[model samples]
Structures are given as C-alpha cells and as structure tokens.
Target: MNSSYDSLVDLFLKSLRAEKNASQNTVSAYANDLNQFFIFLQEHYRKKADGIELEVLSHYDIRSFLAYLHRAGYNKSSVARKLAALRKFYRFLNKEKLIANNPLFFINSPKKDKKLPRYLEEKQIEQLLALPDCSTPLGLRDRAMLETFYASGIRVSELVGLDLPQINLDLGYMVVYGKGAKERVVPLGSFAIEALQNYLRRGRPVLLATQNNDALFLNYKGVRISVRGVRLTVEKYVRRLADSLKISPHSLRHTFATHLMERGADLRVVQELLGHVSMATTQVYTHVTTSKMKEVYDKTHPRA
Candidate 1:
C-alpha cells in the first residue's frame, strides 16, 4: 500500500504543474496551504507527516484544521481559502483512486458574513483632502497623495509601489501594477492632476535632494513611501477632519467606487478603474448605494 504522504504530495505537485497548468503563484499558495495542513495533521493524529497514511485523514481532521486556524487568529477569508485548497486536493486524490473517499466532500465551508466596507461621505472626502496644507513641501506631497488616492481608487500597495515613469501627468492617467503583477492604466481627476503638478514643482525637488530617480511619492527620509506611512498620513488628515467618521486609506477607495456608481457610472468602467478582476466584485458598491436609498425612503415616507 502507498502510505508515504510525502510521495503523494510530490505526485500532487507534479500533477498540478502538468495537468492543472497552475501558475507559480497558485502553486506557491497550494504548497503553503498543504504544509500548514500537514503540520496540523501531524499534531492531531500523533503521526509524522511523511509517515501518515493518506486514508488516516478523516472529516474530523479537516474540522480540527479549521478550528486551529480560527484559534490562531486567521480571518474568515484566509480560513475559507485554505479549506478550498484542501477540498481541491482531496477531490483530486479520490479521483486518482489514492484515497477511498474524499473527507471534505461532505464538509461544509464556514459561513462568511459579507460586511459592507466603510466609506467616506462626499463632503467628508472633500474635507479630508482640504485638510492638507499645501504651503510646505511635505504638505504639497500629502495633498498629491490624498488626491491621487481618491482620483484613481488604487490599492495602498499599488499607490506605494508607483513609479515616476508609470505616471502620465499631461494625459491625466497613471499605469498601476495590481495583484498578480497585472498592469492597468487608470485615469486621474483634475484635482489629482493639479496637486501632483504642485508636488512635482515644489515638493519632489526637495525630497530628491538626497535620493535620485524614478519613484513617484517619497517619504521625509528620501525613500519611496511605504504602505504604512501612507496609511498613517491618511489617518492623520482624517483625524483632523471629523471625530465621528472613522476613516482609513481604504475608505477613500470605497468612497471613490461608491460615489462613481451612485453618479451613474458604468459598472464595467468602474471595475476597470478599480482594477478588479471581476465585475462581480465592483457590483457590491451598487448594493451600498441601494441601502442608502432605502434609508432615505424610510426616513421620509409618511406611512403608519
């Protein structure tokens, strides 16, 4: 009987490469998920990972792995993705006749509640953007950062990773490399263009004194700004605007998407601008607008 789990893992990886044609990122994700699962199985079943029989894995083992993930502070999304990988692996094993049955076939995934993302109101967004004083070089840079965030709706990672050559200030657009290193060009608003022009003229030169070259936004230390630094800068300005509205850099992204949808923008256009792989992901903003409309209707209707 083939009892070596390591051999099965090797075969599975080979199959993924040859038959599944999985990308490098997909292969890496599967490897990590399986390694974590193997560790959990070893601890729970009191057997070494390489020595454990494939058939020894039961539905209880799967449940235990999920429980361990939850206890270790993983969020629902992470847990769900891990479980999905396990399910796919087990299904493959069963199909190959290596396992008698798939344990995860009967197991249900954890119910993940879809929480509507928090976003800023239009007036609050304006207030936050205006909060940055543009007289000083740092202030000009901050203003440009704030405007670019709202105008492009790019992720903080994408924003921090921006390069000078990727931006076309005269054309009012910038190219962003998003998740999976996929590149897309997004248009900037007039406000962002103006702020960026001011920063390039006044702020970037001072920042460039110590460091030379192609990064778009820089920190006080003359290096490219980090995601954490951008988040802190955003939080600082948000705090200055209003005490009640809790805001983060991502709130600006949500506001940009939501406001565009509310203003009759094409969902496909918004999806492309947000660099969403699926239009389904961008459609959530419409639900947010619909919920707001219901709130206003309930408040004004005179029915008993």
Candidate 2:
C-alpha cells in the first residue's frame, strides 16, 4: 500500500502493542476491524486514503461506514464492535494530538439491548454439585471443576487458564488472571477445597500421561482442558438436574456472585473476588438479590 497508510498502521499497531499492552487476540481483532474500515474508505471516497491523515475523518464518513456495514448484512453485535474499535482508535488519536476532535464522539452508536444473565438458585447449585459422583477419577475431576467455578465466581476463561501453581490448597485460595491480565486472589470454599484435594490425590494423576504439570484441570486425554470443554462438562452435570434449571458455566458464576450478595457479602469484596474492573458491574448482583428478597417478602406478608 501507500507509505503513509503503511506508516499509520505500523504506528497504531506499535501503540497498541507497546503502550496498551494488548493481548494477541485483541491486536488481531483491532487489525481486522481497521483493515475493513480502510477498505470501506477506499471504496466510498474513490481516492485512496492513507496514514494518520485519514484519522481526520468526519462523522459523515463514520456514519456512512456503519451504514455500509448494516447494508452488507453485518449483525448488530458485529456493527457495534466495529464502531467500538473506531471509537477507541479515534480516542487514541485525539489523546496523541493527532486529531483536533474525535469524529466518533459526534456519531451515535447503535443501542444494544441488555440481556440479563441466567443464574441458578442455591438449591439448584447444591443439586448440580452433588450430581458429580466423586467415586470415580473423572467424577472427582468434574466435581472439583464445578466446585471451583461456583466457589471462586471466576470467568470460564480465567478458570481454564488456571495453573497448578496458582492454587493454595492449604489456604483455600487461588489466584486468577482476568481481563487485561489483571490478577486477583479469590478464596475457595471448603467444598471446593475438599473436591480439589481429592482430584489432586486420586484423579489428576490418572489423567496425566506424561509430565504435563502446568494446568490445574485436565481433560480425560491428559491435556489442559479448554473453555469449551469446561462448558460442556458443566452442561452435562446441569442436564442431570431437572430440565427446569437449564444452566451454563457462566450461570454458576452469576449464582456465586448473587448468592454471596444475598448472604450479605460486601459489594466491594465481591467486586474484588469477581475481578470486575468496576464495582458498578458487581453491584448488579445486589439488585438481583434484592429482587428475590422483595419477591419473598411479597409472598409471605399478609397485610392486605
């Protein structure tokens, strides 16, 4: 391509890599989005736009780009992500004084509906955990996995990425690496600790074919378990429970947070345990718990 375009791409990528410390997946996503933006500009403007000079693009251009995406049959979520990438890029440019204003600041993003997360009741959680028969080696591993998910309230991504060294069995705590590579230590409940101990002693070694010693949880094939595998295993156990309580692995996370709040755990502490970047995100669990309490009060009170 043109030297100016090449230089801008390189500069932006270097900023993301060196300054932002973006993960490989994040960098790849940004590159893909920006590349699409460049192609759209080339086709619409009829002149090949290049470099940081293109960073001076107007709200009109951005609107047209978004319109083009919609017309090209892109889903709302994909369109939203593309707009987000553009906004981030423009903010970076404005921060560096490469632009007088952010065009994205003027353009309105499409509204996205908030979908409430599904969560299990305390009884359902108990039933699901008990569903795993700890008599067999695989059963012990599955039991430990489910217990850890509920006890720690960790994301499936964080859970699957856990290493053996991160667990402090004696102390009943585990360190989780979350988004942006931020690390937080979360306490494991007694049940999770017991399950993990059983897995470590009787189950994990049976799964290991070689000295694959890094992962905290492993599949039957002795490899580090994947996020999908974890989800599937959780699904399998949830299905064993009544069909009324259909749940995913993330549901366990929600249940963990909500149950903690219902039990009067501090909001900030729950935020820290969940590794939420903002307490506001963690505060939603309080609302969920409150709604349940209100339902109970309405049902029991007879002051008609």
Q: Rate the local accuracy (lDDT) of all candidates.
A: 0.86, 0.85
User: Over 4 Å off in model 1, which ranges?
Assistant: 1-101, 300-304
Residue 224 deviation, candidate 1, in Å? 1.0
lDDT of 1 by residue, 1-304 (tens): 1247767777787889999899989988987898888877767766564533557666777888888999999998899899998888877787788877667866888878778989988887888889888898889999999999999999999999998899999999999999999999999999999999999999988887465568889999777999999989998887788777778888889999999987888889999999999877888888898988788789999981
Residue 300 error, candidate 1, Å: 4.2
Root mean square deviation (Cα) for candidate 2? 6.2
RMSD of each: 6.5, 6.2
| Worst ten in a row by lDDT for model 1 | 45-54
**TM-scores for the candidates:** 0.70, 0.68
- lDDT tens digits by residue: candidate 2, 1-304: 4567656666777899998899999988988898888888777886466645475677888899999999999988899999988888777766777666677877877876555668988887888899888888889999999899889999999989999999999998999899999988999999999999999999998898679468988998898999899988988887779766668888889989888888989998899989988887787787788888999899999972
Model 2 TM-score on a 0 to 1 scale:
0.68
